[model samples]
Each structure stands twice: as C-alpha cells, then as structure tokens.
Target: MVEPIGGASTGALVPPDDYFDVIKHICKKYDILLILDEVMTGMGRTGAMYAYEHWNIKADIIALSKGLTSGYFPVGAILTTDEIVDDMMEKGGFAHGHTLAGNPMGCAVALEVYNVIEDEGLVENSAKMGKLLIQGLNKLAKRYSIIGQVRGKGLLTAIEIVKPGTKKDIFPPEMDVNHLIADWAFKDGLILYPRRPINGLRGDHILIAPPLISDKAVIEELLELLDKTLARSMFMLG
Candidate 1:
C-alpha cells in the first residue's frame, strides 16, 4: 500500500524522480498488487485528479475519502478494475457492504462536489497555488533558523522545525515544538497539523493543507500570519 501524498506521517513529497515511480516499476515487475491509499491526496488535493496521476502509474485498488464530499458529509469510496470485481463476484458477490453504503443523499452530494470542483477548475487552482505556497515556504525557511526544511506538492505541504543552524539537527521531543507551533498558529487564527518525528523518538513538523479554492491573496495572508505565528512561537520557546 502507498500514500500518494504521504500527508501528516511524512513531510516528504513524492516527487516524480523519487520512490513512488520506482516502486510502481517494481510492483509491476513482480506482479504485486498495488494499493493506493489516496484518502488525503485524492479529489485534486495534490494538483491532480488523483495523486497517482502525477506519477502516471495506476494502482490495482484505490481508496478515496476526505475530499469526496468536501467534508460536507461523510463519504468514501474504493475504485477497482472490472476484473477485480468479477473475481470477487465469482467468489460470493463480494462479502462486504457498509450500513450506509450507496446512500442516495451522500452520493448526490459527492456528485455535486465533483461537479463544483470541475466547474471551478479547483485542480488547476491547486497546482498554481501550490507552487506559490512552496516558494513562500522556502523563503521563510531561509529567514527562520528553526525551519529545517519545506516540502510539499499542490495544497499539501509541510515544514520541519529543527534546532537553529545545526547540521542534521532536530529539536528534542520534550520541546513539543510541532504541537506548540500549531497551537500558536491556531490561537493566532490559523490551523496547522502537527506531526511527530518519523525517525528516532523525537522531531517536529507541521502539515499545511489549504483549501484548493484559495486565491493568491488568501495564500499571501496565510503566509503572513504564519510568519508572525512562527516568530512568536520561537520567542516563547526560547
């Protein structure tokens, strides 16, 4: 299984030149069943209709949620090839169904969400805004010693908080740096998702996923607020 965008678990964006494409090649070579968990990256959150589209590789099964209904209602879906469905049907008509599976209201809402996304060209907006967001974050990284790295694709992005001016250095766990930053940002009227360290027992990172429909001005405002929030948080930390 693979998370196309990596989300909160890893600040690393799946670049075309990186592991995602290589893993696709390997999975095909070995006839492995590839499952793409696109819960966070699906529905144009990553600039593409699906995050896998960025790699131009297909997965045997794809799971989608979150943006399926734009959080207007709780809904999710799994997509698979007809061959897979046929196999399941032959074995007993597929053995699973949710209590609210195929509810007309949810399906209708989801359909409207798709229509709105397409009509407003949200996917294209995500791509454009994403570039600006990354550029702004990189600039911030240069200015802030605590910002170790900035990485993202489309509206999905993250910044790693680290010890200032130290090589390969991360803030100690006891600092709760990520959570502190998030709390500060929230109190300042911005919300961010904090992630714990992927390596060792401690590290600090925060995920930033702005709405796909955000315009340049709104993004600029977000960055400005973030800048203030970071400065305040660092001051308190010190």
Candidate 2:
C-alpha cells in the first residue's frame, strides 16, 4: 500500500511526531511507499525546511507547493528518491509538462523566496511562535465549551468547533458557526480558513496558518482577536 500524507493534517494524526513513527513502522511491515503532501506545510511553514524533516523520518516521494514560491508565482515540485526519478526517466522523461512549469521568471522569484526564508530565519521563528499560538489556543479551549480540541504543530493549527452543550454533536451548517467566526476574524484583520468536511456540514473547524514571519506580538494580537471571535461566535451558535 502507498499512503499519501500531509503534515499536521486533520485526518492523518495528531502531535505529528507520533504519526511519523507509527507510519514508518507500518511501512516497514507492509512494504508500502509513503508519499508526503507538503503543499501547505512545506518550505518552513511548519518551522522546518520541510515539515516531514521535523519527524526525522524519510519518505519515498513528496509533493510540494503553496509556500514553495511564497505565492509569488504558480509552481509545484515532485521531490522523490533517485530510484523513482531514474525509473521515470527510463520510461522516457516525465510524460507531463506544463507550459509555465519552467518559466524563468517564476524560477528566479522562487529562488529569491528561498533566500529570504533562509536569510531571515523565518523557519526557526515559525517554530518558536507556533508553540506560543498553540499554547494560547489550549488556554482558550479551557474556558470555551464550543472548542472541542486544539491540535497542530508549528503555524499549522486548528480549532474544532462543536455544539455548545452537546458532548459530541458537531455544529450544524444551518448555523454556519465556523463562517460566523471566520467573518468576525476577517473584520478583525485576521483571515483564516473555515474548512468544509468532505461532505457538507459534517466537520466544523477553523484552520489557522499564519505567515512564518509572524512574531510573538503578532501571534498575541491574532490570538486575542481569535479568542474574541470564538466567544462571540459561540454565543451566536446557541
């Protein structure tokens, strides 16, 4: 079996470290290939060169995008072991190519983005501030009935919203509680992702992925607004 993985993904595993170890063991036993999806969590988004690197585990392939070019230009990469590359080349050079894939302008910009990330030490900063953000959210969860859980590593975190008084009953979209929170957050100058479940109205969560360059003060400001938004939105859901 070949498994597709994402860093700190909601459905994959929690705490990330454990997930890597567990998957590595499973792969060893089942002779499976691990394919990591690093689009959202790649290129220092999770305060590591690549999010998977933090786990000290290796994968057979990794699909990277999003922060790879810092959103300056559209581009993506398929990083894999030499065996995979050799096999594909033997089969006659990647059977796919996009007109814009090798654009020089995009390549140049992406290079600069990499340099900026390294020079400014944004990845390390992300690691530090991400911890602060998660800690703060956990504190907020202590006082709110609507917050079911706070889980994430680095700048990738999520706040799961559930019905205020129902132990395991999820929030219904008829209420759009996540939307209410997102709207409030936007007005507060902090844009966030209120994710949809694979199916409508099944999952309710606000995914938080701030810029890696954010500092403690910025995180505090964002969390302050987030906390306020949570409070007001939770009240509205009821």
User: Taking the tens digit of each residue's C-alpha lDDT, what string does model 2 give over 50-101?
Assistant: 8776667888988877788999788788789999889989999788877777
Each model's backbone clash number = 0, 0
**How do the predictions measure up, each by TM-score?**
0.93, 0.88
Colliding residue pairs in candidate 2: none
lDDT of each: 0.85, 0.77
lDDT of 1 by residue, 1-238 (tens): 9897787677645655667768878997998989999889999988998998887677899998899999889999999999889998999987788898989999999999999999999999999999999999998888787888888789999988888776348777777788888988999899998988456356578889999999999899999999998788668764
RMSD of each: 1.8, 2.6
lDDT of 2 at 47: 65
Using TM-score as the measure, which candidate wins?
1
lDDT, residue 125, model 2: 91
